[model samples]
Target: MRIAKEIRDDRTVLSIQEDRIDAHNSGELKNLVLKTLEGGAQNLVIDLARVQFIDSSGLGALLSGYKNANLRSSGFALAGLQPRVRSMFELTRLHRVFDIYPSLQLALSA
Candidate 1:
């Protein structure tokens, strides 16, 4: 898994560069999120624009990361999900659990 990080405004944008996020690499993804949070960002915006696939393990990683962020009085959100990825969240009812933005720009503005 390839992950990129940037600070947009005051939010940390963690962009993922992979089509599949599963048991094969969910731990790496989670670690990247932790590193971003440790970088002094309170608002976490995970940019999933390039991700086209995800499985249970990936979803679990996201939820765990969000929970960790929330523990610090911060929170994690998502942006730029493809239709297939979006559908998965909706199917699992996680779409309601997370704040989904149309793009990273909008997420940053929020």
Candidate 2:
């Protein structure tokens, strides 16, 4: 798992330090996100600046995380999407679901 999670200023930041997230580890990725949520950080921001690649399973992880956040009445946001990954979200119409931001600060503000 190349992901690192931290809580700062009452917000959760999950940093994906990997170039790719795929079927082999998406489940673990999802678990990490859930763990962050369960750990009491309600405002979530996923920093995707380093995630140059993502498969369907990775996308599933994001969607599931969003669902979990919604169910818990918390906020979920995405930040620093690479153009390629952003394209995938656009193609899948998921760009509409996630509140994307240019930076972590912006996401936290929203």
By lDDT, the best candidate is: 2
Question: How many clashing pairs does model 2 include?
Answer: 0
lDDT of candidate 1? 0.88
- Which residue pairs in model 1 clash with each other? none
Model 2, 48-71: lDDT tens digits are 999888888999999999999999
Clashes of 1: 0
Off by over 4 Å in 2: none
Using all chains and alpha carbons, the TM-scores for the candidates as numbered come to 0.93, 0.93
Task: Compute the lDDT of residue 19 as modeled in candidate 2.
Answer: 87
lDDT of 2 at 58: 93
Instruction: List model 1 lDDT by residue over 1-110, tens digit each.
Output: 88888877667888998888989999999888877777677889999998889999999999988888988878689999999899999999999999899888788888
Model 1 residue 104 distance off true place after TM-score fit, in angstroms? 1.1
